[model samples]
Target: MAGSLPPLLLVGCGQMGGAMLAGWLADGLAPSVILDRHRDDIPAPHSVVRQASDLPDDFAPALIILATKPQKAAEILPSIAHFARHAPILSVMAGKTVGGLTAALAEAGTPGATVIRAMPNTPSAVGQGMTVCFAPPTATEADRALCTRLLSAVGDVAWVADEAQMDAVTAVSGSGPAYVFLLAELMEQAGIAQGLPADLARRIARRTVSGAGALMEQSGIDAAELRRRVTSPGGTTQQALEVLMAPQAWPATMEQAIAAATRRARELAS
Candidate 1:
């Protein structure tokens, strides 16, 4: 609620963090303190104090949301670890691992910060994002519930018990939005091939993808059902589907791509 006590300290107010912040404000939960080196881009919320050397003199937060770049997190952790040590941390960085953060924080004498690795995609900016979270084994029921409620403001949230699967989460949902945009790109090119004007092709292609996505959101049915609805038997949509779903087509290639990203996730963590 707007006037209610805050539970979080957000570090790095970039795109992903901004998405989460927008979600929280929309849901009526605002962070008590938000810290970022540059505060220009964030929308001003009256209650959130964007920059202060330390957290407020009030009760310490139970959670800290980290949305900084992976490369910058290691550099920033030591300075900010004090506020985090007493709180569970949720990180949205793509490749950084909690272990590295833990070690870095420990060096600052700020130990015992529980880390929850989260991967959220760009769609979160519009409240239709998919967020996958992997919390430590010691994470309690209350902790999970708190995070689930906080993150749900952005979009749907799922939990993975094994942290090892988080890399795959990053590979899939984390990097998945760009793939959809890539589809739009190819669709535009296809329209150009069909002899439409370049600008018109671009508009049509963008609208087609956007409309399909909106339809999926409004319809309660699973994607398969929706596909079937559009794909009449022996029709144009069906023909396109046949090629798109082929063994060596987009599906298989996507699987391989996601796997590669997962491997890269592991490498980054190491």
Candidate 2:
């Protein structure tokens, strides 16, 4: 299968897992198995089972994706620990450390399992995701490359040397989509307040946000430079920027928001 991914054993098929699976399927995936209780929409050649107990005896996966909820690790890891001996585990569970997952697998009879962690956002559903991964020293370069290849099917990928940075990454990119959506919401409401028709307001607000994002991606220009290019000395955009860019406005608010999100991410770590 030229240009196809290797076999995968996906342990969960919730939002994040399903998003990645969609990208993989669109890009030509090898035969794979998805272990999920409630999903039956997977096409032929890719099997879906209700539980780990139903997994085939002779199936071998090159990579095992752990996309289950972080709290479910204790119950799930032990059941799948045997696979760890043969494949590196890539976990998309938030706040679960590589050390903690490795310890869990070891306790379940699979010692020295290679574990990698990643933070990916909801945009992955649309194949525009930004995922940041952290691989511990025990994981080989091949393990890292495998993760990159699978994740790149969805969107961009990057690596961080220090696991501690993952908290900030979660704050900035993992949770960043909500912040952008909020901007669109506010913009739409403001337009309505200005007496624009509700439907027109909604369309313009959403399009403006999405169009700006596309321009940012395709132009390859710095965001600040783009902002400068749009702002004239005494134009309407400048008038709005004057208020929004106040010392205690978006600048300070965004800093505080990111710091709070980062703090919460660290607090959630197991």
Candidate 3:
């Protein structure tokens, strides 16, 4: 609750959108209205208009949060085209530039709509997310600040001056969850290959990743410090680190993966 947050409007209520809604509700933000083609997932006691075509004439939302898939933005825009001309638009669609959103909003009639585009990671579902955003050049400073505060309701939000950096942001945070999940999967498989019981392998992998993450979060120290603390000269941990960080190793592989994702993001934007 940033004191004077706009009357909320949620466009897509999928996982990311649902997580945001949960955060808002937990923070006691009862949106003026919510819209989603599907409505089975939201909690009880919500007031949703449900359809764009049937929008109530008297209703006016101060901020419209577009949380739909990047590919679906065009399809979703016309549904709320009327709001494009009035409300400041806050978007969380990856690879979508601010100018593109403004154009969409202009087509909907909100020629001067203040637009903010953001790339948010999956951790927002638990308030541990990393989010980056960029505002249109025409956006007023006050509007940008309001957008930041609005996004902060869910998790950590940082502003980006360059919209071109958004694809890199998408590669880093937007695709980061999947990368971590893949690491967990590979860790479990490795444990199983080491002859541990399947159940034990799964359990150990889950706990190790979770505990390491928790320690990193709880401690104010940097991750490098924590990693060094676990390493000892000529010890087992050192041996593992050597293999993982060597010239031809996981770090390089991860960089390649990130680059590939970055390229794909650029392609999507194009």
Cα RMSD of all models vs. native, in order, equals 2.7, 1.5, 2.2
TM-score of each: 0.87, 0.95, 0.91
lDDT of 3 by residue, 147-242 (tens): 777678778889888888989899998889888888788899999998999999999888888888889988878999999999999999999899
Provide the lowest-lDDT 10-residue window in model 3.
1-10
| Candidate 2 structure quality by residue, lDDT tens digits, 1-270 | 333998899999998889888888888888899999989999879999999989997889999999888778888998999998999999998788999899999999999999999998877877899999999988999999999998998899999999999999999999899999999999999999999999999999999999999999999999999999999999999999989999899999999999999998887774
Count clashing residue pairs in model 2: 0
* lDDT score of residue 180 within candidate 2: 99
lDDT per model vs. reference:
0.79, 0.92, 0.79
Report the C-alpha displacement of residue 82, candidate 1, in angstroms: 0.3
Q: Report the poorest 10 consecutive residues by lDDT, candidate 2.
A: 1-10
Predicted structure with the largest lDDT when compared to the true one: 2
Instruction: Give the per-residue lDDT digits (tens) of candidate 1, residues 1-270.
Output: 573425677888777888777667666654456777666554455334445554466647767888888878777787677777567888898877767777778887787777778898778877788999887777678778877877777899999887778898899888888888999999999999999999999998999999998898888779999999998899999999999999999889988999999998888776
- Which rank order by lDDT, best down to worst? 2, 3, 1
